[model samples]
Target: MNKGLFVMALEVSNLNKRNVYLMYLIIFLQGFVFYGPVAVIYRQRRGLAVSSIFIIESISWILMIILEIPWGYFADRFGYKKTLVISNILFFISKIVFYKAHSFNMFLLERILMAFSLSGISGCDIALLYSSINEKESEKVFGRYSALSNAGLFLASIISSILVKYSLDSTALLTSVFYGIASILTFFLTEVEVKNKNRINIKLCIDFVKSSKNIILLIFAVSLINEVVQAVAVFLYQIKLINCGFNIVYFGLLTAFLQLVRISSAKTHVLSSKFGQNKSLMIFFIIITLSCLAFLTLKNIPIIIIALALMCSSSAMISPIILDIENKSISIQDRATVLSIYAMCGDILSSAVNVVIGKVSDISIEASFTFCIIICFFALILLCLNFKGQFFNKYS
Candidate 1:
């Protein structure tokens, strides 16, 4: 390469680092409103039943699945930066609604708003970041991004623990402020120029499907791992803590602990290199399987904590590896749409399964955990089949 060309590339790399830093800041500010600790507790305090809460969450995922592609199309056609700003605005509005909500119906409305906002965010954010840097750096970049986002959650967890002790409403109010700040930060995001700026249409969709079908299949195969761990198990673990006679005030602290574990685990390459990505994924699946068993068989706090650590570690490990595969396999112009399709797999599963999980939890928490164990076993089998067939060879 010419010296001048090399210098220009170096300058662009430096600029990309700056943009990534801005993204980190936005992620951190949004983390200040950490709702994970308060999510179930907040609904219970508002007089909604557990099943009702799960139904609301399921509805949210349903909306996410419905709106994901459209919002992804918007990001591709309009602008990732503008779409992100709109998403932040929607998040702010949702938080305000959540703060003012007194009835189940009111909370449902808030979740609907939230789903749309998150739909706009999930695909576009990753697409923007991946586009900003060299393709080879995407996995490393996502690892750093996940770590910083976890750090934000860790800090927020401390405040959330204290705030929830005071009032759930207070947490909601502060969360809204965080979203407002994050929205402002989005204005500073550097937009990547797309070479093929085509409008979304049937032909485009068909092309995406044809090109990404294999990766999409693999994505669906691993989707259960994510849904079972993050969407289902974590919430149940909170209920488990409450059942074990722990005070609600400690929920935020517990959430923070998991975030710490995730922070440690987000550095993907070391583990992937050591075990190989395929074997590493197998290890994570086995760990999750074991954790599900622990929840079913153990009641001691120490055992519960160990199980949660495994869950968190596996959750962190799987995301970047899978994301790198999905993101790198697609074209820049179609990145958001393809990634949305990937997310839609997980959302579809979570939406369908949460209601059943909720009802089972209502009947028996152990039964719910048992149900998860069965799903994990099935997921493990699917993963094995994929690997044995060399499904991920192309990505590797």
Candidate 2:
């Protein structure tokens, strides 16, 4: 096999699976800690305007967008381990600040710090995982990583529900403690070497942008649509469940259940290779559209649960497929930066959509769901047009 082709092959043994698994565990714990407070922020701070909460989130995302590529480049040069350690320490500090925050401004400050820390860590972990594997197997390796991370998030959601029910402040403190643990565990991670130690030149960024324009555009569009759908679901589901007389605990449980379904569905790689990424994505989009439509009509707990599961599962399925395609198209050296750009686009769009959706929810929950359906439909059309050719060819 050609050297480049040989490196592209993804085998499980080639990766430091144990370290990846540990990273996944720490991330899962981090999610559980972070989200426990976030899941109830709107409810806890109900006195504050919903617009205020959205603005804070939007600001955080904007900060993340600005920081992502710089941090990715830093990782590419300094080593992934160093970046991970710094990110975890920053995360720990941010959690402390969040725990002590007494006002909205304080919270926003902590949020900004958190966003910066998260940006520093975002693509670096994936880059490390990719380095551990052969280049060809990057997609499959990333798929497994995605699945594990989702599973962590899912588990964290469940724990968050339990902690939030008892005491939000305590939950915040506990989450901070978990971050400390994650930071400690970071020391155990093995460092990966960058073959080229040259400073990240402007040309590399330009080259990545030029070469991966189509994939980048598709990723941005899909990410924005996905975020809108998610934001709407977040706002709509809360109101819908409340209207249906479900308690907060039950709502959290339902959310956790959906995450579990998503994590499980994400692990399966057969769809991407067998049906092809583009076709698989289209099918998943259809499922999401149907699920959202069902949500508009379904009121019963059982039916709503089923619909939410389908929506979550389908969304989760689409991510790995899209990411696999994205990973396949980029060179190893540019992978983190390219992925950071992709993430930045998604975060910016999602933040904007959240603000809009929050305002729309205040006016009418039904209208918000209607908006989501429209967005998903448009996304479906884009996927169809962009992916008309075989999955890999569209980007290649």
Candidate 3:
């Protein structure tokens, strides 16, 4: 047997098992971030001002955006497993750094590490998973892939309810410990061999992507909705809860509920099979638009919780569908690179939305949600455009 083909030939069963199981386990472990509920409080306790923290986050986003394509290229050129191993190591190191960080600069260092780690993992992990599984199983695998992370996050948020009241440092330490396990798990992942390992031609790739923008538009549109829902959930929901006189201590419980709703991502394949992809996604964006609208106007807690659940469900359900579409639209040779570019476009827009949301949030939470409404409208429009042309008859 050729040395390069040994894993594929002799270890077919093991390769199939390790790639899927390890990725799921790694993602779940990575989600055990005990500091998730108290990230802001932890930073404030460490003496960083809100402005400085936002600045650091923005810088990290920028760095991640800048490195996204390059990291993807590296995964394509070198190997996916190597990239994931290096990325997981950096991710664990970043967690450890966060555990020890006290000053603004120290926290900034952790973000810097994260930008590199996350950028590398973005396209490579999916590319690896997509390669390992039969095409028919993509939906179930991707669905479970998404749900398990929420499961980890849900469990972590529950633990955070107690851990936060006791010790923030311990919270950071335990989070890092889970991340440490994630790093080790990456070592067990089997790399699916790339069909084309030749050096990428930059200009040719650019022209090719330009020609394929329609299929790409699907993820871009979904990204807009996902980012808006995510920003609202992470940044502003707490304020809304507090304004309604909800106690801060139960925030972890509230967060757990949100994560619980996100578990609906695993059911999206069923929804897509029932309604078809276009209808299911259209329904999601419509739910998002209405959710944002209700969140803006309603004072009723039950109504608000229902709206948030719809938004979370919409956001989670769209991801796997978009990913399936994206993977089908690309050739195996350039899959990781194209996916990274797609993700980069989404990140760029996310940064813009975050800026819009942050600025408008300072003015009023209502204004921020209003901006999300406008974004959802555009996303809904783009989602329709994705399936309209003759091009998608080929990819769709």
What TM-score against the true fold does each predicted structure earn?
A: 0.92, 0.86, 0.92
Give the poorly placed runs of model 3, Cα more than 4 Å off.
1-10, 47-54, 390-396
Question: For each candidate, what is the lDDT?
Answer: 0.79, 0.70, 0.83
| lDDT-superior candidate, 1 or 3 | 3
* Model 1: CA > 4 A from native: 1-14, 210-213, 231-233, 391-396
Q: Write the per-residue lDDT of candidate 1 for residues 208-276, one digit (tens) a residue.
A: 756655565567657777767854445788888778887888888987887888886557877887888
| 217-311 per-residue lDDT for model 2 (tens digits) | 57765875687556645555666666777776655566667667767544547777788766777788887788777777778867776877777
At residue 382, what lDDT does model 1 achieve?
75
TM-score (C-alpha, index-matched) for candidate 3? 0.92
Give the local distance difference test score of model 2: 0.70
Worst 10 residues of 3 by lDDT: 200-209
lDDT (tens digit, per residue) of candidate 3 on 295-334: 8898787788788878887888888888898788775477
